[model samples]
Target: MKVVIIGAGVAGLSIGWRLLQAGATVTILDRAQPAHGATWAAAGMLAVTAELEGAHAAERDLALHANALWPGFASEVEQASGVPVGFVRSGALLLAPDAAALDAMRARGPVLDAAGARALVPLLADGIAGGLWAADEAHVDNRRLGEAMTIAYVKAGGALVPQTAAVRIEQKSGAAVCVLTPRHRYHADAFVIAAGAWSGLLGDIPITPVKGEMIALAPPAGAQLPGPVIWGNGVYLVPRDEGGQKLLLVGATMQEAGFDTSLSPDVRDQLRAGAQSLIPALKQWVLADHWAGLRPKSPDGLPLLGPVRSGNIFVASGQFRNGILLAPAIAQLMADMVLGKTKIIPAFDPQRFAPRFV
Candidate 1:
């Protein structure tokens, strides 16, 4: 089968790779370089228990399933692309501000006292209540993962067309025929709109862009970052060793600012403050890097998966903060749906928010 997937973010690239592995001819079109969007800008947190807090049942199950698949998925991508994506099982520390909040956190994992939390990281602030220790939490080098997926897809015989922005889907006889781009029309048996924050622009998809800003902090001389991810003060500090430099990634400030990715000093200070609140020594950490990315969010705060509106055209967008974590599951499910091997998941159906006539 011939398949054309729009957007070349992790979702699109992974799906294309899966389809190619299944003997289907796949072509991925991206407006810019593949995986340079949210997939690159993400903190790469595989916080199954932390991220899924208050999440609905379907999304929770999907996240857990994806988390379970990540180990094998990382290995497969690495073997295919010959690149180490820096997948780590370094767990996470989620701190609660008060006793009531600490009690609520117990449902997710073991509750750690303030002393215990400090013992795990040794960088945590003193005047803390308690936190949850989620041992199953993990993280990956998202930027490296993107590069690896791109290489893996191409190595698997999939055509990747960068700078090819798909404008619209051309349909005939109630079936998607091709995707029309500025330079060329891509004819295929199936078309997928996985264009991250831009998915809504192409069709009736209700995806919107939620902008998030992040900053990296490098420890001072003789100081080192904590081994596990630390979450509190409305920020998550993810430790990463890039090229032998250990840096703490402090993020993020969520805004309704549509498609605006410019950095702000005020936001940077705000992130630093949040990080310092958890780890007071962060005040001495140097600000290494600051950037922003747009997350694709739906109205219902759930991903839009499977078919868009009863045609071969499908959508695998609106993953919001979980895009990097959900890539493997999205790829497998979308590939199965495209191949008629599995039914569309009801909770994630793109047709859930169908336009109604007044």
Candidate 2:
């Protein structure tokens, strides 16, 4: 079977990798170089427990399953590519620096506690009044992971077409035939639409673009910030394995504005200052690098996965804030569905957004 995966982000590479394992001939198409989009800017924090708070039961279960698969998946990819994905089991710290935040955190402690929080993270200071230790969760060096995925995809007999913009997906006889590119066309038995924020741009997808800005900083003079991911009031401070350069991935403001990845000083300063409020240790980390990416978002805050109304057209976008965390399981499910193994995740099916299909 010749499977064509559009967009070479983590979702695309993961799908291609799985399809290759299933003995499918895979071809990946991307507008830019593989993994250059949101995957490049991701913090690589696989902190499911940390993100589980206030999430619906279904969402939490999905996150937990994905996190569980990560260790084995990372190990397999490392063995195949001979490069570590930098999986960190240090756990995530959810600190509450103020009274209101502390109160809210305490309310959600039981859910995180059940996810092995206490065993995974550090105990907080007494006066701080609130914290959760999500122990089973982990983090990864996303940059290396992206590179490894793309490398492994190509090395496994998969074809990669860089700088090829997929202009449109043409559905005929209720099945996807071939995607239109700038200068050529390639037919496929199956098609996976895993384009990040661009998922909705494909004519009928319901996904939207939510802008996210992140900054990397050199750790304080004392050394690295020892943790998986630090989530306080307004920021997510994720540490990088590269020496003491910590990634201050902060202020994921949910904006409906279309595809503006350029970082604003206002957003940057606000994010940096927000991190300072969370972990006081951040007051010393020197600014290192800054970037922004668009998240595939939706009004309902749920990812649009599963099949499209048209045949051979599947979606795995609208992940919103859980794109990185959901990568493994989403790809696995996509492969399973493509192989006719089981019913896809029902809620995420694109049919949900279709008035007639409903």
Candidate 3:
């Protein structure tokens, strides 16, 4: 089968890889370089248990299932691309700043006393009342992962066309037949719109861009910010180990700022304060980088998957914050649905928002 996927972000690249592996001819089109969107700026937290507060049962189940697939998926991508994506199973620490917050964390899962939490994360602030430890949580270097997926897709004989903006899906006889770009029209047997926030622009899907800003910090010489992803005070501190460098990703300020990717000094300062409150030693760390990206969010906060009006045209976007964590499973599900092996989950069905689509 010939498949053309729009958007070369993690979702698109992942689906492309799976389809190509299944012997389908694949082409991925992107308006910019691959992984240059939310995938690039994500903190890469695969926190299945840590991020389930507002999630429904199906969403939680999907997250857990996706987290379970990460180990093997990471290995497969690494083997296929001959590149290390830095998949880390370093667990996660959820810290509460006060008694009320501590009680909330306790209600969620197994929590530790202040002493215990500090034991695990030595850099934790003394004022922390208590928290939880999610041992199964993990993270990956998303940029590296994106690069690996791109390599894997190409090595598996998939095509990637960057700088190509897919303006619309061309349908004939009630079936998607081609995609129209400014310069040319590309035909394929199947089309998947995995364009992140831009997915709504194609065919009136109700996906919106939630902007998030983040900062990266380099640990001071001979001192390391220890243990698991740290979640405290509306921010997360994710440690990144890349090429013998120990860096921390401090983020993020979530806002309904549309497609704007601008960085604000006030937001950066707020993030810095959050980080220092979690790890005081971070005060000495160097401010390395800061940026923003737009997360494609659905109204219900779950991904939109499965076919639209056109059977062969599918929607696999609206991953929001968990896009990096959910890439492998989302890809597998999308590939299966496209190949007629499985049906879309009702909760995540694109038709759930049918009124908006119409």
Candidate 4:
């Protein structure tokens, strides 16, 4: 089968790779460079249990399944592209700024005193009352991962068209036949809309962009920050130690601003303050970079996967915060659906929100 995928981010690229492996000729179209959307700005956390505390049972199970698939997925991508994605199962540390926060963290896992927390992360501030260590969580360097996926997809015989904006899906007899673009039209047996925040532009999918701002910091000379990810007080400090760099990613501020990628000075200062409050030694580090990306969010806070009203068109967007963690599983599920070998999960069906086709 010939398949055309919209949006060459992680979802579209990964799905293209899988479809190519399944003997389908694939073409991926993107408005900009691949992986320049939410995938590039994410902190690549695979926190299976820590992020699923208040989530529904189906969501939790899906997250766990995705987490289980990461090790193999990372290995495959690395081998295929001959690039290291900096995948690490270094675990995560959850900090509590006060007694109340400590109590809340204790409910999730074993809480350690200030001294114990300091033993794991020496730079932790004295104001920290306690912490909870989740040893099963993991993280990946998302920038490297995106590059590797792009290389693998192209090497596997998939075509990528950058800077091509898909205006809409052209249909005939109630079936999607091609994707309409400004300069060209792409015809295929199947169409997959994997556009992140821009999925709604083609049809009536209920997806919105949630803007997030983040800052990167370089540690002082001869000083190592910490091993695990630090989560505390609505701020997360992710350490990137691979490739001979001791950089900490401190983020992020979530705002409902529409399609704005500009950075804010106030948000940068707030992120710096929050990072220093958690790790006092960061005050001596240098600010390396700051930027923003828009996350595609749905009303139910879960991804919209599988076929929509258009018989041959499928959607694999609205992954919100867990897009990185869920990419591998989503690619497999989407490929299976395209091959007519699997059933869609009821909770994530696109029709749940009454999607309209143009």
Query: Model 2: runs farther than 4 Å from truth?
Result: 98-107, 110-127, 220-222, 243-251, 355-358
Q: Write the per-residue lDDT of candidate 4 for residues 109-214, one digit (tens) a residue.
A: 8888889888899878888898888888899999899999999999999999999999989999999888999999999999999999989888999999999999
72, model 3: CA deviation in Å?
A: 0.3
lDDT of 4: 0.90
Total backbone collisions, model 3: 0
**Prediction 1 global C-alpha lDDT:** 0.91
Tell me how many clashing residue pairs each candidate has: 0, 3, 0, 0
Worst 10 residues of 2 by lDDT: 110-119
**Candidate 1: RMSD over Cα atoms?**
1.8
TM-score of each: 0.97, 0.90, 0.97, 0.97
lDDT head-to-head 1 vs 3, winner: 1
Q: List the residue pairs that clash in candidate 1.
A: none
Per-residue alpha-carbon lDDT of model 2 for 1-358, expressed as tens digits?
A: 8888889999999988999899888899999999988888777878687766677677778888998898888988888787778888867767655556656766554334322433343432224544565667688887888888988888888899999988887767777888889998879988888888997777677777877778877765656455667676667777676533445455455556788777788877887887776555667778887887888876678787777777587787887778888889988888888777768676677778861111
Candidate 3: segments with Cα more than 4 A from true spot: 355-358
Which run of 10 residues does model 3 get worst, by summed lDDT?
Answer: 349-358
What tens digits encode model 1's per-residue C-alpha lDDT throughout 152-207?
99999999999888887887767778888998899999888889999989877788
List candidate 4 stretches off by more than 4 Å: none
Highest-lDDT candidate:
1
Whose TM-score is higher: candidate 2's or candidate 3's? Answer: 3
